[model samples]
Target: MREVSSDCRVAWFLGLAGLIPFVAGGVIAWWGSSAWQVTAVYGFSYYSAVILSFLGGVHWGSALQVPRPDNRRRLFIAMVPSLIAWPALLFNVVTGLWVLLAGFILIGGYDLSRDGREGFPAWYFKLRGLLTGVVVAFHLIVLLRLGG
Candidate 1:
C-alpha cells in the first residue's frame, strides 16, 4: 500500500463525517417514535438525493478536465445520477427510497468502474467505494424498517 497523504486524510475525514446523517437516520428509523420515524425517514431520503446529486457533480467535474468533444458523452453520463435522484423525490416515501437506492447502486458502479482511470486518485475511488457501501447499507436498513 502507498503512504497515506494529507489529501487522503482530509477526504477520509469528510467522507466519514458525511455518513453521520445516514447513521442517525437509520438508527432513528429503527427505534424512534412514530412521528420521529417519519421525520428521520424523510430527512434520510432528502439527504440521499442531495448526496446523489453531489456524486453526479463530481463526475461533471471530471468531465470538464478533458477536451470538449471527447467529454460530451462523459458529461451526459455524469448527469445520470441527478436525473435519477430528482424524480425519486416525487414518489411515495417507500418508492422514493427504492429509487434512491438504485441511484446509489448505479453511481457506485460507475465510480468503481472508473477506478484508476480518468485521473481520479486511487484513494478517492476507494473512499467512494467505502462510503457508497455504507450509504447503501443504511438505505437497506431503513427500507427494511419501513417494510418497503
Candidate 2:
C-alpha cells in the first residue's frame, strides 16, 4: 500500500480524535447513572448530527476542486447530510440514534460510491471507511442500550 502523506496523516489523527465523543457517549450511556446517561445520549446524538452535516461540507470542498463545478449535483449532494440529520434531533433518543446511524451509513455509501475509485485518495477513503464503521457501531450500541 502507498504511504499516506503528512497532511493526510494529520487529518486521520483529527478524525479519530473526533470519534471520542461518539464512543464516550455510548460508554456513558451504558455505564452512567440515569441522569448522566440521558445527558450523554442527547449530547452524543446532537454531536453526531453536527458531524453528519460536516461530512456534507467535505463534499462541498471536493466540489470546489472541479473545473466546471456541477453545482446542481454537487451542491445537492452537499445538502443531503444536514437534511437527514435535522429530523433525527426531533425524535426520541432511540429513534433519533437510528436515524443518525442511517444517515452516517448513507453518507459513507455516497462517499465511497462517488469518489472511492478516482476522486478521493486511497488513504482518505480507507480512513473514512474505518471511521464510519466505528461510528455506526457506537450508534448501534447506544440504540441497544436504550431500547433493550
Candidate 3:
C-alpha cells in the first residue's frame, strides 16, 4: 500500500463533508414544502452531475502517470465519465438523478479496478467506495421518497 499523506487525509475529510449536501438535499426534497423540494432536487441533481464530471478529471490526471499505449486508453476512459455526466443534466429530475447515481457507483468501481491493475492505492479505493456508497444511499432516499 502507498503511504497516505496528510493532504490525502484532508481530501478524504473534505470529500466526506461533501456528502452533506446530498443527504440534506435529499431530506429536504423528501419532507420540505413544494418550492423547497423542487430546489433541493434540482440542486442535488446538478451538483451530482458536476461532481461526477470532476471525478473524471481526477482520473485524467492519474492517466498522465501511465506509459504510452495504456496511457492513451486511460485518457480515453477518463473522458467517458464527464461525457456521461454532462448529458445527464439535460434529462428530467428522476432520470437525471438516476444517471448521476449510476455514474458515482460506476466510477467508484472503475477506481477499484484501477487499484487492482493500475496501481491506484487500496486505501484510496476504500475511501472512494465509502463516499460513493453514501452518495448512492442519499440519492436513493430522494428517489424513493419522491416515488421516482
Candidate 4:
C-alpha cells in the first residue's frame, strides 16, 4: 500500500470540502428556491473546486518534488476551465450543467486512473469521487427537470 503523505491529506481535505457548496446548491434547486440563493450556493461550490484543483496540483507537484513555478502553472491550466464554467452555469443552467458534467468526467476519471498512486488514503479518494458523482447526477436531474 502507498503511504499517505501530508500533501495528499491536504488534497483530500480540499476535495472533500467541495461537497458543501454542491449539496447546498442541489438542495436549494430541488426545493424550488430562489435563483439568487441557488446561484450563491453554487458560487461557493465553484470556488471550492478552484481551491481543490489548486490544492490537488500542489499535492501532486510536491509529491513529484518539482519547482513552485512548474507546479502552479500546471495547476492553473488544469483548474481554469472549471473556474470559468461554474460561474457561467450560475447564469445559465444549461451551460453550467455542461461544464459541471465535463468536470465530473475529468475529475472522476483522473481519480480512478491514479487511485493508489496519489499518496492519499484510499477511502478519502473513494468518498470524494462518490460524492462528486452524486452531486453531478443531482444537478443533471435538475437540469433535465428544468427542461434544459
Name the best candidate (by TM-score): 1
- Clash counts for all predictions: 0, 0, 0, 1
Q: What TM-score does candidate 3 get on C-alpha atoms?
A: 0.89
Clashing pairs for predicted structure model 2, backbone only: none
Residues 1-148, candidate 3, lDDT per residue (tens digit)? Answer: 9677997799899889888889889889988999999999989988898889988887788777655557777788788788888889999888988888888888877777744247465567667788888889999998997788
Among residues 3 or more apart in sequence or in different chains, the pairs in candidate 3 whose N, CA or C atoms overlap within 3 Å are none
lDDT of 1 by residue, 1-148 (tens): 8788898899899999999999999999999999999999999999999999999888788877765554777788789989989999999989999999999999888777743147587778778989999999999999999998
Cα TM-score per model: 0.92, 0.91, 0.89, 0.57
- In order, the Cα lDDT scores of the candidates are 0.89, 0.86, 0.82, 0.58
TM-score of 2: 0.91
> Which 10-residue window in model 4 sums to the lowest lDDT?
112-121
**What's model 4's overall lDDT?**
0.58
Write down the worst ten-residue block by lDDT for model 3: 114-123
lDDT tens digits by residue: candidate 2, 1-148: 9766899989999999999999999999999999999999999999999999999988877777663435558768888999989998998877888888999999898887844223567788888999999999999999889873
The prediction achieving the highest lDDT against the true structure is: 1
* Candidate 3 lDDT for residue 80: 77
Off by over 4 Å in 3: 1-4, 66-68, 114-117
Candidate 4 residue lDDT tens string, 17-110: 7667666665666665577556744564465446445435534554456444355544554465456554754655566666656665665565
